[model samples]
Target: MRSTNFCLSTEGADVILATSSDEKYPPENIIDGQSETFWTTTGMFPQEFVICFHKCVIISKLTIQCYLVQTLRIEKSMSKDPVDFEHCIEKDLEYKEGELQTEEFSFPEFQATHLRFIILSAFDTFVSVHRVIAEGIAQDI
Candidate 1:
């Protein structure tokens, strides 16, 4: 029953795709395990990023820290490749000026090798994700 932040880049998590990214705000920052660094959407709504874990894992919960994000949808995939993701959860966040939004999601029975988070919309022209933490254990499948 070890708990770990599977989203850390050091943990073999990777950001496979993103709609738009600024040079200073690359998607890799979201999983860097540092709150100071972050990833930002360059433009438009419906921005997305896919995270591939090192191996299949049973995800128990997730913590997303972002700013200016209005709506978010998450999907998970158990396939070896990043595809055929099924819906996991969707949430609408509350916005507070000069403050970061911290949202937590729990899924006791969720297992996946990849997770995709889609930013459906934002409260502002752009949104920034400071960090994403996935707490879970690697499954021996």
Candidate 2:
């Protein structure tokens, strides 16, 4: 059978620590399948969060929805634990007034069990990450 793309969050994906947390706007909101809910920065710049897939996933495309963020970086790891991640992509996002910033990345071939998103900086004092979606094929293991 041919492989098909699907959202990892719907298949038992979860976010790791090293992320700013708030009860009303927790980091889990980034993958909670709710657009109105988002994870907000509780402190200074260079905030980040790691997402762990339930299993090995070959992701071809990744999308992140946020606002006021100026620079961001994505890293990936194939190990069982959320460590030893290699640099994947880094890009600066454009600011849109009163609008959410949607960033999409298409990879040639990326296999990972964990993904880490690093927010280098933002246009405002704080940033809000609405959601993170990974589209790919999950491995049989």
lDDT of each: 0.92, 0.85
Tens-digit lDDT string for candidate 2 (32-130):
877798989987989999988858988888888999999999999999998899999999999989999999999897899899999999999899999
Q: Tens digits of per-residue lDDT for model 1 on 4-93?
A: 889998999999888888999999999999988999998888999999995998888999999999999999999999989999999899
Model 1 misplaced stretches (Cα beyond 4 Å): none
Q: Residue 140 lDDT in model 2?
A: 70
Supply the global lDDT for candidate 2. Answer: 0.85
TM-score of 1: 0.97
What pairs collide in candidate 1? none
RMSD per prediction, one decimal?
0.8, 1.8
User: Alpha carbon lDDT of residue 38, candidate 2?
Assistant: 90
Q: What lDDT does model 1 reach?
A: 0.92
